[model samples]
Target: MTERRPRKDAVRNRMAVLAAADALFNRRESPEDLTMADIAAAAGVGKATLFRAFGDRTGLLRALYEARLEPTMDAVKAGPPPLGPTTPPLARIPALLDALLCFKLDNRRLALALEGTAGAGPYRAANYERWHSLLKVMLEQIPGMADSDFIAHALLAATRADLVEHLAGQERVPPERMRTQLAAFTARVLGTRPTPGSNAED
Candidate 1:
């Protein structure tokens, strides 16, 4: 005997739930606090239907976060200058940092979630690695930077969620000071030897 397939209503309901979750999480920076009932309400379906569609919060967050972050880095890796290819190696490092700081400020929770290798599993790890790879490639293009890839990995580590939270959230450092420090630190690691031109000392 043949198995029965989901009806069109089931399919539409599933898509709507995913869409609602993605909008809430990605656009508004909502966390896994979103519930099946919330998704069902947003999707105009019942709670049981959302469970049947997404299984659990982890499953939905994983799928939706992957869908968002993977393409995000892709655009960063390919779009125009300052973010993508075609920017000068020296300028690109600081530019990337600026973009990243904005991203962190906007998606602070999701960025925090990616820090631990657990829970996120292999897929999130792969996304982190992708960000590292793009950064390393930009570094490698710089002249005399022999250990650019290794240096890029180090830069990535330095910009992690723990440090960002401590410095910005707890210490309450001013945004300009933070930007100057990050650019200086990143530039130093990449061996760019910053000029003493109007930046915070140390």
Candidate 2:
């Protein structure tokens, strides 16, 4: 059966809601405080429209997060070495971790808001599972790697949105430094030497 496309106004409303949500998240320090009404008002749409389009707060967050993640996800799926499928697992794993860390850092507020929702814990989140499954596959490819599943989880834990927020917000860690630390940690886990000039300590 052929699927019917959304009406022009529905598409426009979705885009407007996404844009307004993005702006609100970027502008606010605590995105968790942002309500559906706030985003509806900002987008000049009715609250009913927001709920009808997104179903609930969690659905809206997932949509917005996925929209923001599209470019990075594209690069990871088919772009050149380090993230692309063509790269060696040994190299690609770290690159993937680095990319995830950067993404969390860049979208800290949105990440925190989404991750903090009830029933949306990191372990069960669809996006988290996707990355974990990909990382586990890569880890299995590397020679002599053990417990790829647990390793994938451990590696991803380092870049959790809550941890990122704590490090980048409360601790005020520099972005470069966090990247360096993550790279060094990933290297250690993969049983490889750390990159030049990178160690466990600052």
Candidate 3:
């Protein structure tokens, strides 16, 4: 069976919505501050078009979040070490954590909004599930790493968007410092210190 492609205008509308949403998120302090109507107006589209393109606020957020996270996800999935699968578990784990931290930090408001949205809680969110599953699989490969499931959850907790926002926005922690602290925390959890120059660049 053949599937029909979206009309060109549909594709253009989706892109415009995403771009407008991205801009809104960047300019606003809270994702809750922006609404579908605002995005629709910004994109020069009708509110009905926004809903048709994204289904709901949560859907729009997920679309924008995925669009922003795509590059990093691509590297983790297939690019070279240390984010790539071919890297040793010990190296790759920290690299992955670092990448996730940087991603949340870079997309602070959007991440916070998406993860906080109704029907998209952290446990059930697609992005969180993917990271947790990958981290669990990697942890399982390491000898003596007990309770990979819990460990992955615990490790990811440190990178939660709200926590990142607190440290970055309230405590004024520099990005490098946050990255260092997270690396140290990951090492302690893994019972190993990072090798020199082993931390992946943000």
Candidate 4:
């Protein structure tokens, strides 16, 4: 049989389904609990159409994570003063943590999901490797900083959302408190002393 062309309404319905799923998963604390029917009802589409748009629940979740993670990434990259590209890496390093801290507050679940996937598959390998390389470049700016590679690994480990979640949830530390120390500590690792009482809010 010949391939059937999707009707205009069908295309619109699929986009609606994915959009609804993205919103629900990103906004909720327990995104993993979302079901296809829940997504369809929210989208005003039939369950079959939801599945057709996304092959499985995982695909839907992935779609949602991608849509929402941009703000988190963008925040760290450009939303604020020191974190934005206009600032030197020395300032951006600590500011990245502050900007990312706000992102963690807004999109913690999606942020955790990205962090969880950072080292498993080939795609993740490429992303992780790229970030590692970027940190290595940042380290080059610091005179005589030992073992840039090792330090990069340590810095990444310290700043991850999973670690933050543990600190915030299990350790009962407030997110703001953890972010304060995390940003200050990250700057120290980069071989720069944070200026006393210097404001670095993103």
Count clashes in each candidate, considering only residues at least 3 apart in sequence or on different chains: 0, 0, 0, 0
| Cα misplacement distance, residue 81 of candidate 1 (Å) | 1.7
TM-score comparison, 2 vs 4, better candidate: 2
List candidate 2 stretches off by more than 4 Å.
Answer: 118-120, 195-202
TM for candidate 1 is 0.68
Per-residue C-alpha lDDT of model 3 across residues 1-202, encoded as one tens digit per residue: 8999999999999999999999989999778989899999999999999998889999999999999999999999999998997999999999999999999999998888888874545777768889999999999999988999999999999999889999999999999889988988888899889646646232
lDDT of 4 by residue, 160-182 (tens): 66776777778888766776677
Q: Model 2 Cα displacement at 117 (Å)? A: 0.8
Residues 112-174 of candidate 2 have per-residue lDDT tens digits of 878877365677665998999999999999888999999999999999999999999999999
lDDT of 3 at 92: 95
User: Model-by-model lDDT, in order?
Assistant: 0.67, 0.89, 0.90, 0.67
Which residue pairs of candidate 3 clash?
none
Candidate 4, which segments miss by more than 4 Å at Cα? 1-15, 26-29, 46-55, 75-80, 113-130, 195-202
lDDT of 4 at 159: 58
**In order, what is each prediction's RMSD in angstroms?**
5.3, 1.7, 2.6, 5.2
